[model samples]
Target chain A: MKTIRLLTTLKLALFPLALQAQLELNATASFELSRGGDKSHYFYNEIHEGYSDWRFGLAQANLMAAWPFGGGWRLQGRLLLERKQGERPEQLRLPQLNLQWAPQESPLRFTLGRFLYPFGAFNGRQLPTERTFIARPLAYSYYVNISEKAGFFPGMGDEVKVPADGNTLWGSTMLYYGGYAAGMKLHWEIKARKAWLDAAVVNGAPNVRTGLPGSPNWGITSRFSVQPRHWWKQGFSLAYGTFMERADINAGLEKMKAYRQALIGTDYLIGFGYFELSGELIAATYRAPQHLPEEESFAGKALHLKALAGHGDIRYSLPFLGGAYLAYRFGMIHFGRIPGRTDRWDNGIKRHSLAAGYRINSFLLVQASVSTQQVNEKQWARRQQAFRLMLTAFY
Target chain B: MLRMAILMTTFLSFLYLGARQEAPAVIPGPHPAGVSAVRNNPEAEPVPLLRGDNEIYGLIGLPRPRKWVARGHAYNKDGSKVMHSDDPMAAPNRNVIVSLHPLDFQPPLSPTREAAITQKDQTFLPCVLPVTVGSTVYFLNEDQFVHSIYSLTLRNIAIGRRPPGEVHPRKINKPGVIQLTCDIHTHMRGVILSLETPYFTRADADGRYRIRGLPDGRYRMEVFHLDAGKRMVEVALSGGQALRQDIDYTKP
Candidate 1:
């Protein structure tokens, strides 16, 4: 309900852009089929049912429209609906409603309202038409040993159970997978249009993906990219903010700046005719509150948490064959340890993904991928695997 | 005798201008290979197709370049020949499309057939592909990445890949120039010309073009190239007279 209200408010804010100019509409719909999840395993979500059988459905639909409301103001909006395998029902989501003010002769652009604000380099192309694979990178989709509501607890005690159901608390991803965060962003082109810098301030921790802007904490994210040629690009990113909203179990929200999440990253892309290579490395640390599951109501001491994640991909377009390419990616995530013990705070994870993609033309694309996840913690499952096929059509 | 002489002179002058008036769409600008992806591949650009013995014939002239010629460049970091390529730019006079349309609204219906522009090696073959009006042009993908072919010049047409190798053919009924480009690869481009009249041809090595099968009538000729914009001239043929017209690049 809160998310719906937030989307409505965003719609009303950007609705004025629809009043002028010729509305240009674009749409892309996708269907997906996948297997390899169980009821107890932490699937795409930390605290959700991991449907145990082969399942398929309309994976996603995006209806997008743009209006140049003259005077250097243009509005772009997308209404999206996504479905997963199990319990979660399909709901309409307004992931983007950005109003940008860029003049004909200016090198700078200002974008306002809810958007997939650029905290990382990959956020720019989240749609199926733009993405290369059927599944998201584990850095974004894989659940980590951090919680949005209950924070983090190191090494479960005898009173705690694995896959705790009653608490509704588990590890969450560092960044909300595809959630659009409301913010005002400024973009500047420098170095003779060869480089670009983007900076934004959002409602809360970039890792928190809620559509609502109820968090008292504000986070700042920035990234700079340089393109020396058509086939090469490099980028660096940084983000910092108070991530925890509940002060009762966390720290004091407004005054305690130490209870925050800070992230740094670098990414690069190189396309050398027949093949392309790309990769990103991210490092994040958190000064988050930690408490025992049995110690119900206390603002426990802060725990220093750190993580490093990196992914590399290489794609090759076969010679003499049109619109057929094979890609392989390797990714890994490692967590920091507790202060007094040699044990780590969360599970160390790694994933391998391989895919084959073909662009039939501009209007349609198809990709099939197989992915495997491995956890290095004794308390968690050792290995999990999934296979997915996706079809995307654009009009 | 003086009146007869004056009538003869006037008659001769009218015939001179009328014979040369067959329109050519002459466009003059930087080579399209410098700006857009069209006609960039010179080493392997397929020659434009044409009819043999034709109706209208002429030599198309473009001003010799002075200094600035934008070219495709490839330089390896280590300056090694093992991983470097030197892509040549398309010649200006080649790939020029010249067509004749009847001044009267009734243009002779040209035979239409299925034509294809193949996408291979991340570049389009035959950068300039011409077909008759209402011809179905098939875009075949021969490279590894998904490539979409769309043109915004005459019709807003976009073809997606349903099958890996071939796409469903799209018929182009409109008579004009269409700029084809891949949505995935911005660097790959091609052009398709749909002609309403049956008489049209491309320029030869010496900047010449010819057309055939017209029935002694007023016609409009159009000439277009990536570098040359568009040029138009009105032509009047009478008593089945073969005409010679020259297109100039100096006239802009």
Candidate 2:
């Protein structure tokens, strides 16, 4: 509530300044409604039962304002207000709120405050309106346990197990893939507007259970991209971070509190005529729990986990229809297995998606997608199929 | 689960059918500023069709096709290897303007015939435009926001701010190229060609052009395109000659 009030006050203050400077104030609201179904023994889209009913997927609004004080100084603020119906709470997020300095004749820029993480295209894809599909990429949606005790399976202990359907976190220990981060960033364009390099240091990953501290945990991310033509671009990114939180890993053993993660990714995009093609590859490595329950650890051995994920898609515009397109995507997530590890949880999964969308105009879009997910291992040989339809409107 | 899938499929089918029934006009794609030869919009109001007695119909052949630049890696659909070609693909030279110099002939109508250039989705429709010397061109703001249309040509004509649904008309008193731009959108640009003659036509994607309503006599043909700059040639037409002039405008 206090944060909301502060944001509202800041917006009110910027209104007069906007009028004085004759600046453009941008505001848009978007809504998404979708439904999906699964057909596997263990729910297709989750770690537990694989079924989720129809729901209002997302409702969000974006507000932004920028003011330039000549001589290379500019102030800009952007807020994202989201109402996650059945997923989480209604919250306000500051995607970008910073002061920037860029010399009039130079390509270098310095920024401070909360800014987007310059790791990969996934980190910057925070809005549903900007994404091509209803479901996020494979790596961005995967979940891993950060607890000290051995993670529970479907038929674990007497404790009640809840279905983890794209949401729900055990504690501040686990990690949520890429989102927004706060820190100082530097950007330099090397060769005109064709190439750029960016580096930033931000508060640790999205495992912020205890809230962001003054200066305890920090992460570093960097990216480089080159656009040789007006319609083509390619880039690479890297991120390394550490999270320090205290949690009881095992009941009978001492608690483990520290963890680290690293990532390397490459992305490519091209648009020619009425067709577009894009793809991304991400490889991540993270530390395993130091102490685990006797029966939970794989052969009572602790080992780091590594995963490789990638996705590629092709979209073609229907020449007959002004703003309609058809797209097909293929993605896979492969998890490395430890020596003598018997658990199937570390197996690989692949997904194939086909979607069609029509943009009514500049502010409205309707899309439908059908996808199939299958595990790589034959022991877990079950295929799950799902379908989703979404309508998004922005103003 | 099967029932739900069937229901969703039915709903989507209905939506698709409904959308197919309403074919909306789309804004043209973005182009580099001040490139008057590129017209990316085909949905704009069609040009008045040419139907009369005499016509000049022929393909404007290029001496050689423009070569495609090999930049960063451009992969094929299968992601195997980058597709490279030694020669250019089919039909390279497009958007070339073919006109005749109006020396002795007079235009049929006054320049009062008005044509519109609209602002939609932050892009100026009909990026490459041609009109008679006295024609009035109206710049209409069809977008949701305001746009300032200006031209820095000879006299520096500036049409202040035009709000949505408003139109600003400008008269062309002389024959010259007037480059139109928007102060708000740096990428929004267009060109207004004020020709003294009405016998002007743009070439199709296949480099074929046809200018009708020409009298049977000798005339000078002027060709304008981005790649080859400008060139002129002389041709004569007799009774029902059906002038077939294939011009290879590429410079040696």
Candidate 3:
């Protein structure tokens, strides 16, 4: 068959490279169980199943492969496989595939292909296996209505709907949700003893159509960190980007009038002894044409709307507990009403989570968390609570 | 997914083509050129050993530090006094470096050997190690997580991180005491003592040391200790004579 011939050709092509280069393979597998209130939803709707009733979730696996060759070149790729749920169908997805050239002696480097956004700490620790808690923060996982037909306010073309079973809204997710984009990045760093200044410029948002090499949108990220004394490190970060919404692209829309989202955020991380504290604050503005329908407007003719979100968390390790730790996080997301809309129509959500984890061994971990979420509007103000337990293994 | 598959195919093809071509690895040139003429010839008449009747043997005694008088009281967890005074025998020892250098003795070339300093449970095993110059020390990580071992005192360069079960080797070519620290686990600290002379030994926990295989001659004995400080003395040895030199660091 043609498929068999192609497979044979591929194997032969990869055999030599695999043997010649230094390759490393790693994987993480997890089984999770969770339950949520009647009206709560999963922040990253594309990833998680559901959170309504007690459900025995299926196992999820992420496999990564890295090949480091001569000339400071490195190639890395990750494959994710999980069960089907919600609008996200079961499938094998390549979450990351990139090549990097960072020489050990140089302060400048370049990366290309699909790589995680270097905006904040969230992007740096995006994988579930690396996160301290079972769930992601609201600032990185919350959903906002970007549907041209139905906005987040009242009297839109179609009224925005929330799943009765407490599932995430069907809308455009946050930029940090599964933050990966296909483009190029230039990174630079200057180190002085224990301190460093890191900066980068890249095509921030994912444009599925106008993929690789370059995109219509771009962003910048920078961080400065220093340790004044032993056992302590503190750092701050600033990021800005303009994101394009592919779903809203139309032939009739003008380039300037095309719907696009702009974001600016500041973040910080501090670690001392057995304790670590980190937080981030972000503001996003979405602009549309002035000729849009009144149903999507704030002042009935406004062209832009802004949303503000913030998150903070603290974690501590108990030295006597062998490898046990506790973590707490608080997050809030606010959506401004259409320019002309009243305060009552504004949308927001607040979440608080407490989690504890025990490392059974280097490869295995057990974690449990309880979280509660509250909506802003009185109609949907029922405090939503959820409990989650996970067993994760990395090898 | 299709795009990724295409990308992978393209990358594989490129790699295969590159491999077929003469792609050479980049290796830096030799160290900076320096001109030096040999001052001594090994093929010439060898210098005879000390004209003595017998081999010289010696014992060096190390006295307790005088400033370290037992004063602190030992207490139990309940705030009750357990001991009236701290253990005198527990006073710090084994911190001294003793070396014997002859006025005309040229240290023979010593064979280089490899040694390992292991990382287990986020701590370094055998916290202090002494190795001859030109010897290589391999830092092995036994723990699951990655560990970074660096010495800024001598080389001023970070060796970077090594994963579990991996070994990172560094050849110590200079004679100096270097302190190693882990960037991730700040509590972990280690020391590597690189010595130029083969006739050197560190004192034991009881302040006793012995350096074997010395011909009958006069030696300029040099002693360096972190707590006891430094001391120097000239010792003359005759054939088959057992010399006993007791050093009282308490006065110095």
Candidate 4:
């Protein structure tokens, strides 16, 4: 709350500069209503009142600004506020704060401070106004059975079995849910930006949002993409580094650095004549536990425990409206098996999402969506499915 | 009230001319702040469509056809478009402006004319525009969003924030390529081809064009395309004869 107040004060102080055109300012406000399905997800996009009752979730607002200096330099920041049920209800987030130097007609650009980890092709389009759907990609939102503090829980004894979903200690994403990390990033580009190479060194790996103190854990991420044609693009990315929290490192573990996360991903995008299709596939592995409970660590027989995830979505613009579109996405995340277990480490989850959105103007958008988790078909049938209605406004 | 009356009059006149399937009467004058042309100069009178019989008629044929597929122009059974677009690819060589420049003949400077570029559907309508050096152009926001229309080349014409249903005007005095863009929508782009030449007209969907009322003279015919840039060809018109020139981009 103090941070939020400070950010508000900072914005108030900068209003005079914004009015003078020295600062480009914009904001996005969103309200969401959801019903059915599990409501315990982190970020609480699926919060619901009852099985038969619709529930209101959030009144989220993001204040964004940029200060463009002469000679192609800029400072960017975002302050996010949301009223909802979550780990930090009603708490604001300062996710995007960065300084960039991109000289005009230059092939290379540099950025520092806290910024979006340049990992996936879609990382840059995290704002609701820029995307077409209400439900985020499951690959980016789903938390695995890995404890952010104690590490992966699969192939372990009952003492360290992974807790339920939404546990603060165990909730982690393949991409840290697009977290803005303290980092430095750079990109080299050419051919009207048809091709580029982006690389970043951040505080921690993308899967776990934890970092060791004193720079003991640093993640290096890189991506290379090319658009050989106006309608097609392809890229590949890789991230690797020691990512365990200091707590896990101090837990009598051997070779703590070996318990890192390494991920490899490839993505493609196709857009032409009002139709857009994009997809990415990523596979990551948390190096095997060097030392743990004899029964929990499979007697030191467990190899690298792996997770494979991907998502594909397509959007078709509706010609009748200024910016109306319908989109469908399918995503899945499946885990590798333990050394002695007859089943995979975790349930292989699949989700199918359908959404329709209309941009009333440049500043406002309305979206309605529904999604079903196929892996929990039986359990989730209690709520039937999840439906979401959202309104997003920008100024 | 006078400004409002002029706006209403202009709107009514535009409707009247549009109803008749004829182009509106464009009386251009020099911008008062700069340029050499006077508004009432005798030489700046509206040229007849056909003073004599001297004219240039031709088609601009592209060397190769674009590799574009037919987009959605039909509707689905569900009342939605089959595809998201209402375009079937642009007509060949569209938006290219053709003008004739005389080597030794200095035509009278142009006076200002009221013209407009409407902001609609996240784009600047008439993406390509041809204007005189001193014409007054208005940027109108027809969409339901505010647009910050600006041109780095015409930096003096400052239109900070143009809300919907509002119109902002600027008198362009310099002669050069003025590219306009919206700060809100980076994909939206427009170009104002400000030429000093008096005889200028854009090509039609069929890549065909016609320019009339050229006095007997030696001239340089300039073909301008957004992608192919500008090219010059020399020609002479005498005896009020009609000249035919076909510009083929495939050839040198």
Ordered from best to worst lDDT, the candidate numbers read: 1, 4, 2, 3
Superposed Cα RMSD, model 1:
18.9
Q: Candidate 3 chain A: minimum summed lDDT over ten consecutive residues — where?
A: A149-158
DockQ of each: 0.03, 0.03, 0.02, 0.02
Off by over 4 Å in 3: A1-20, A44-51, A82-89, A147-169, A193-242, A246-252, A256-258, A289-302, A344-346, B1-252
Model 2, residue A34: distance off in Å is 2.5
Give the CAPRI rating of model 3: incorrect
The candidate with the higher DockQ, 2 or 4, is 2
**Backbone clashes in model 3, listed as residue pairs:** A40-A166, A298-A338, A298-A339, A298-A340, A299-A339, A299-A340, B54-B239, B54-B240, B55-B240
Better of 2 and 3 by TM-score: 2
> Per-residue lDDT for A1-395 in model 4, tens only?
99999999988876654444355567778877767655334322334233325656555778776665445666777788864333223867777778888866678788888777777766766677766676667667766655545566643322254432334344467677645567788878855436778789988777755332364677899988887664578999999877665453335555556667888999997753335678989998876453343443323432567889998887755422325567777778888776666667655677767888865544577898987665532354333357888899776
Q: List all candidate RMSDs to the true structure.
A: 18.9, 17.0, 20.9, 19.0
lDDT score of residue A37 within candidate 2: 43
Each prediction's whole-model lDDT (CA): 0.63, 0.57, 0.55, 0.62
Summarize candidate 3's per-residue lDDT along B221-240 as a digit string, tens digits.
77765444558788876566
TM-score of chain B of each: 0.65, 0.62, 0.58, 0.68
What is the descending TM-score order?
1, 4, 2, 3
- Per-chain TM-score (chain B), model 3: 0.58
